[model samples]
Target: MARLGPLLGALVKIRWRTLLGRGSAEITGEVLMLLAAGLMAERFLQYLPEFPVVWVWVGLAVCWLGMSRGPEGVPGQFPLTRGDRMVVRTVELAVNPLSWILVFVTGRISGWGLCLILLAGVEWPTWRRGKRVSARPSRWPALLRKDLRAAVRLFDTALAGVIVLMFVAYAVREANLAVEAAWIVPVVVALSNSTIALNAFGTDNGTGFDRYLLLPLTGREILWSKTVSLVVLVGGQLGLVALAASWRLGWEMGLVVGVEGLSLLFLLAGWGAWVSVWVPFALKAYRFADGGSVWAGLVAFALCLGPGMAAARGDWWVRLLVLWVAGAGCWVMLGVAGRRLERGRERIRERLP
Candidate 1:
């Protein structure tokens, strides 16, 4: 344990430098956005007479997504022992608390804060270890399977799902709640799923794309593989939320949530594929903006909210139509994204360090 300190520091330093190298402008923009968000949140808490429990759910979702996903740095090319991996993760876990400092500053520290802190502590040792992928045709399944495994291994994802289920159970039991408020369930699911879908191809920072380009596979095939994996991952989260809502709120509300959730997920994954190729960003150790992640979040919010609004109106036919259109649109977008990825391989290569 004594020998692990230097190793962890060195790994964290490398990851930090890689993140800052993206660009000064990009980092500045993200920081500004974050500050603005924090200020807005502080104001919301101050002035809003009745802060909905929905935001609590959203906060938990964000915490889970952020904590469960492992560090995005490229895995060391040399072999690492289990101890080396554990030390590397310890460094990553040490950084998690810095985010909560914002909450403390905003004077919002409460049971929720304590709960999230405790949860992060409990899950810290479970960070997914990075894997080395080979650039071979037969390795595609292995690659996809690895991603699927990571998705499930995310302790935050599972915990967030359970919390959502409990919330649904409570919401369904309340007779005074407006039907329009049911939209929150799907919206939350959409936001939660987007954390993974939006960075589909950029999951391993910018390192994997180089190997991907080397593989004897068409961009379309690669894109499809990623899409399938994302659907499986994000779809699982959305499905759980839908099932819980259905069980508690009756099949009618559940049907709406299901359609809305699926539509939003498809839109996010399809659009994310295009972004992954066209505006590809690196999911660096400290930064989230590799490939227009901020813009993607904004776009996802807009898209998700649209379905939520439609759901609140209680128009089942309209909701179904929206779902059909979004599904078809994603299909077309995926094809275009594949072609773009192929054409832009040189550009993507240049973006990587």
Candidate 2:
């Protein structure tokens, strides 16, 4: 038992570094997750009625999602001794997001907590592996399906956006506080996604952008495909979040958040097309972003940050105005990106090839 403490601490440190290495945007997303967890914990303690089933599942969800979502290297690359396994499991349980819920519930219902702990304790690799794969082709084909597949290439980034959306929903639900700053969520999402959004061409290990060239689409058409992909990525997460928030926060908040998210999506998709043409790079999952041009960062700020900051003090209607203006910009930018993509086809091939 005494020897196990040191081993557990060492593995925990390794896990932390691996997570931190994913770069600032990714880290910020994680920190926000903890914050959302903490906020919801307060809400749960105060208002929600207790059901044993609810308590058990909520507790189990904390560690299960953590173990699944967080990358922990290739399974069994290095042997884990008995003590090593014990330590690794302990640390994973300890640092999981929304961990406060698990602790408080355990104190209230020790039996359920123990069972949940035992269930989550067993070895399970990353979450994506546990996902149930679809058997049939999608009913929706063409660009929608294409976009959906591209978004899956780095679904972790989309999950980060989900965290942001959930956090914003809960934050607004807090009593005696204002929800005037809905744009913050979309802004954070845009910046967090900069790793991919900035380099749209490199979504799937330098291969995601290849499918576009296969089609006889023009540059505007190519950019439109990527934009649809972004829409699916952001929109799907937002939908799930709104459903969850609707359960606790009112449905009104969901509508408000939808407006906010759509506003930013227009700006993001429009400007992201330009970034893809002018400042593209390849993306690798679960690692620090290696390459991006200055234009990428500047475009993100000008497109997302500017509108977000302007609407900080106003309510959802202000964001709607920003949405209308961004829609116009999106139209114009799409044209510009298409023209550039058409002219620079060979050059883009040289760089991306």
Candidate 3:
């Protein structure tokens, strides 16, 4: 136990440094976001009186588990010779029983049992195959396809999509909530999309970082490809939100929100590209760093959402003006980020570890 104490402490410190870097503001913002999410979850539960709270808890747990990027190469850097497989399995075994307890306590054993069965059915084949698979050379189509697949596979990405839908549904059910939906929907979508953009290179998990350099594509091409992929991926989700919002808030309001959502996405993607080059960090499954791009996103969201909501109040010219300005700004930022990415490729490579 004495020896394990220091080992655990070392592990925590390493994770903190890797994910959060030295940003106090980032850390604080993440904590506040977490508290806000908890409050929102409580309110969400209140809205669903018929549903079991346990299901929400279970869903949250699953989403949290899915958010994990899994054990990356950092664990390999440690003196521990056992490898990450053992470490990961040990942690899983320790926490999995808690899931079972939640299921049993809720008296939804059968439902939870089926969920476990379905999960096993989906995961078993992948686990059985246990082989290292390499990606094909980076072409735009292939890269986009890969990013889309990765996005779908991630629990948080899917959760974000669901949350957007939930917000839309809530707006549809509660007319009074429409005002909140305008800015809320766009902010949520922007932050969701920014996850990949800001942590662009981190997705390589240290293994593929070097292979990117070897690829035939230029840095600008690589950056643009990722940007386009994320825009499409998150844009599709935003479209659904728009449809739902439109159903409740009317076409004009929906159109305005939709335009604002897309604009926020573009702004975030551009900002993400710049940060990816200038302040890259390794991706982790769970950490405060997950909210790394959020502070900037919130600032942009405020700037865009205020004028957007006002314009939505009934000013066609204002809406058009805001869209044009935001769109132009997005393009300028993208151009600047691409140039920075090209110039800083060497530094980015050096930082990846």
Candidate 4:
């Protein structure tokens, strides 16, 4: 046993020496990270005397980062492994003065706080594990439908009922002129329904089933399903909004806004679908190496807001016309892109490599 212990200790010492001599770059990087962390902690702690509310904000910020990042590697070519991240965070918690200071200032000794601290510092093992793409190409439609059902099921029934009641209460309180009040419902509906278009593809983070690729459904079929789903979702929201507007704005104003809002819903939903398809194509075409497509989507989203805002402000006829035109344009673009994708499937697959 003593002989085995000496051998194990020697191995450990050798490994440590090897890691220590890996490179000056690694050492520099560690130094920079420690310095930056220290500066941030100092700044946060210094502000506590003047701003008591800042602690919660800091906690929230830390929690958000921990939740979102969860143990990913550093942003470089030689990114830290998940285990490395865990070790680093553990060391920081033990040795860093700021960790103690943060604990002291926050007074968060509960299990949740410990969880957050661990999450903030621990390297999640799932990160950077090359994703396994299922090579099945025959079951995309069922897969998408499953996700669609899941999306619908995910909404809280009680929360939605509460939202409805709140809308009614607000309408009753705010209604003065029926025409003006009627517009509010449709606008709310349009905006809320627009959430259905969130980056469905990106949500999977490359690990989840590539449902579209697995199914025999063409891009057109997928687009159609998405469009239909959006129409139903938007229509439901529009109906609710129209009811609310009618309560506050008069029947005529409600009708006008309802129609306009429905049109806007179609336009926004269509555009969102179109962007989703186009983004993947653009990423493939440009051969963007990282998360550049997310940035591109953000830019597109920002640009789309202009038409939405304009349509929201006008009378029923004007809003309807604007939304109709916008919707038509988006539909046309989607059709063109869908056709292009369908025709260029082989080329796209080739580009992916």
Local accuracy by lDDT, each model:
0.62, 0.59, 0.61, 0.47
Error of 1 at 70 (Å): 5.7
* Whole-structure CA lDDT of model 3: 0.61
The deviation in Å at residue 158 for candidate 4 is 11
Top-lDDT candidate index: 1
Candidate 2's C-alpha runs over 4 A off are: 1-159, 165-173, 238-257, 288-290, 314-321, 349-353
TM-score of 3: 0.70
Model 4 C-alpha lDDT per residue in residues 211-321, reported as the tens digit of each score: 455667667666666666656655666677567776666686566655665666666666666655555422111011123255544544553454445545765566666
Model 4's TM-score against the true structure: 0.45
Task: Encode model 1's per-residue lDDT on 1-353: one tens digit a residue.
Answer: 66666666776676566556658886676566455444434432333233343444345434544543454454355356777765665466555444444334323534456545554554554553354555466656777885665554443234435445544545544544445545675576556556556655545545677777788888888888887887776677677767766776689877887888788877877877777777665444323333455777788788888778777774788888888878887898888988988898888666555
Name the better of 3 and 4 by lDDT: 3
**lDDT leaderboard ranking:** 1, 3, 2, 4
Spell out the clash pairs found in candidate 3: 68-285, 69-285
Worst lDDT window (10 residues) for model 1? 43-52
**Candidate 1: residue pairs that collide:** 280-291, 281-290, 281-291, 282-290
RMSD of each: 7.1, 7.3, 6.2, 12.3
Which candidate tops TM-score?
Answer: 3
Q: What is the RMSD of candidate 3? A: 6.2
